[model samples]
Target: MPDAQKMFERITLPRDAGLPVSLCNVSKTYRTGFGLPVHALNLVSLRVPSGQALAITGPSGSGKSTLLHLVGAMDTPDEGSITVGELELARLQERERAAFRSQIGFVFQRFHLLPALTALDNVAAPLLPLKVGFDKQQRARELLAAVGLSGRERDLPSHLSGGEQQRVAIARALVNSPGLLFADEPTGDLDSRTGAKVMGALLELRSKRGLTLLIATHDAGLASRCDRVIELLDGQIVSDSEG
Candidate 1:
């Protein structure tokens, strides 16, 4: 097998370079039934240093997904600011935000793989939209191998196990060589053993690529593996500590 480290080196930023994420007094509110305003996040603020692994934990209504969405640029905050590296996300124009998102990878709980596409095609799909000028297929193949999906590139999502499908999703997320990665309950669909294996692969990639990682999960075991953990309750931060 090709060395995973070498494969990562081809797509990673310099070892000394890592992106820092900062949120200052961020808040988001939603209008629900009866025109009532639901505060999804109330003055939430945090900082994740470069190359650090941070876990976000909370109960079902604690705004974990909302927080992840804001940080990942999938949604904008109604108040305060979120800055990744030197770019202020809230202030970016729509086109600029799209460009910025291209530099960040997101892994959702559902894996989000197209069932009809082979693993290789699924990983390469993002590149087509970005108009990236390189061999997308080669990069996709390398990422699949790096994620230990070698020889399974031709398999459809249905053919793979839950863990295998998640791995493929991870490979797809990394295809653009993002400087930061966001995962929301990446292991939620898998058994414990498989979850552990998937987490191991994620951390290994984070270390090798100098990529900042932020994960939102309810599993304490998974949260404990991160460098730090933040707990939320009722849309507010209740505690933050080292893992």
Candidate 2:
């Protein structure tokens, strides 16, 4: 683990004054089954400005997903820090981290929706923890409509197309109005046409809501659509360029 202060110096700060998300010298290492150490991330640093979208691209085992977990606070780094908004994630307690994570929406490659739950219920899952003033069901319905699933609110995952299910997942992700959205292989299971639709929904969300988007994927076409493309190799970011 490198010293955070020193690693901070190495990161080139973006021009944006208030980047919604940042990672400084973030590293995560694990022991392989063979007892050899594997470095999933090595002194990785990044800053995603507010309302910007960044696509993380790499070959398999290149630590793209690991970087997402770090930024999403699903896991802590072995070294360095990740900050979201004004919050320093490394300094938060476990409960606080959980709460903070609720403010971040995650779309998994597998959808991860409950088979028994309808699209509406699936989208409402995040609001269970908030207990806010609004009606969760009403909010979920609105989100589903926004994603073009207005008539399928009662449909279960089994009944929807891969694209539709993914849209439901996106609605679920945005139900909380999260400042950041983390998507992993968002269109991995769909055809090119369906994938384009999913990307369209994401792009619409970015432009309409100004939501910051980070997608971890191996798809070059998808990565090229984002505002910036970051390449990961051997658990390190080798290149980052504007798209």
Q: Each candidate: RMSD to true structure?
A: 6.1, 7.3
Q: Which RMSD does model 2 reach against the true structure?
A: 7.3
Top TM-score model: 1
- Name the regions of candidate 1 deviating beyond 4 angstroms: 1-16
Return the number of clashes found in candidate 1: 0
lDDT over C-alpha atoms for residue 82 of model 2: 87
Per-residue C-alpha lDDT of model 2 across residues 1-243, encoded as one tens digit per residue: 334333332332232222388899988999988989999999998888898888989999999899988888888899998888877888876766666666678898888898999999999987775546699999999999989999899999999999999999999998867778899999988898998889889978877766889998777887888989999999999999952
Question: Over the stretch 1-243, how does candidate 1's per-residue lDDT look in tens digits?
Answer: 334333333333332445889999999999998899989999988989999988889998889999988987889999999988877787766766666666788998899999999999999998875544589999999999989999999999999999999999999998878878999999888899999898888888898877899998888998899889999997898999952
**CA lDDT, every prediction?**
0.86, 0.84
Model 1 RMSD to the real structure?
6.1
TM-score of each model, in listed order: 0.91, 0.90
